[model samples]
Target: MAQTADDAKYLWQKKLDNGHIRIGFNDVAHQEIGEISFAKFPDNLTEVKLGDVILSIEGAKAVSEVHTPVAGKVAKVNVALKDHPEYLESSDEDKNWVVELF
Candidate 1:
């Protein structure tokens, strides 16, 4: 089947000041997923390969798994999302980002 617009944008990637790669769903995806109610992320420092599942989230619409587009070690994750998943709903890319890959 053809991919939907949201499916085409599986993630938005940005390079941090420290050179880590930050990734998250873009506005298109956020609109599709809605308010995030829950999130599961792999532990920090975990080795991830391209296409590996790095995140799982429950949102207003449906549960989804996010795969990595680049391979690297898990440098950091927005731990704040653990308590306040609504951060994912924000337009602020910094706050919406899920993980930083080394």
Candidate 2:
């Protein structure tokens, strides 16, 4: 499916000042799954291959894996969900960046 302004299929990829690219799922991902409850990222420093399982999210009904479009080192993880997992509901991408690669 093509990514439209109303639908977010392709993640918004941006290069950070550090040279690593930051990526987050688009709104379509949230809309398809409904209110996301759980977001799981691969362990830090773990190598993730393209199309590999980067993160699996549990929505209202189904569980889906968020794929990694690129290959790199997992530099950081968003721990905000530990307290407010629902953040993924309000702000799907910015607050829900599953992991950052280095």
Candidate 3:
């Protein structure tokens, strides 16, 4: 995966080998949100425009939305988050990733 910084604060974009885009939160975002308790993502959402809200995260301090930086079709999501929401607290790239868009 090739990673790039998005213009939006705390958002990172990763380019997958198959030319898809992966969206994730950076450490700064995790710090701002506090401990994450839950995450909600759109179900069966295929197409999305730039800046579309794809996921919502609830933390101890506040709720924040994760938006798409580029227009694309949803390919996959980190379903692990459904059972292990605390994974959002991780700053590790492999753990904090939220979704993949193709």
Highest TM-score against the true fold, candidate: 3
Pitting candidate 2 against candidate 3, the one with the higher TM-score is 3
lDDT of each: 0.78, 0.64, 0.78
Q: Tens-digit lDDT track for model 3 on 1-102?
A: 212323277778999899989888888777777898988887766889987777777788777677788889888888888888888788887888888889
TM-score of each: 0.84, 0.75, 0.86
Candidate 1: give the clashing pairs. none
**Which is the better candidate, 1 or 3, if ranked by TM-score?**
3
Candidate 1 residue-wise lDDT at 55? 74
Q: Candidate 1: which stretches are off by over 4 Å?
A: 1-8, 43-45
lDDT of 3 at 5: 25
Worst 10 residues of 2 by lDDT: 1-10
Best by lDDT: 3
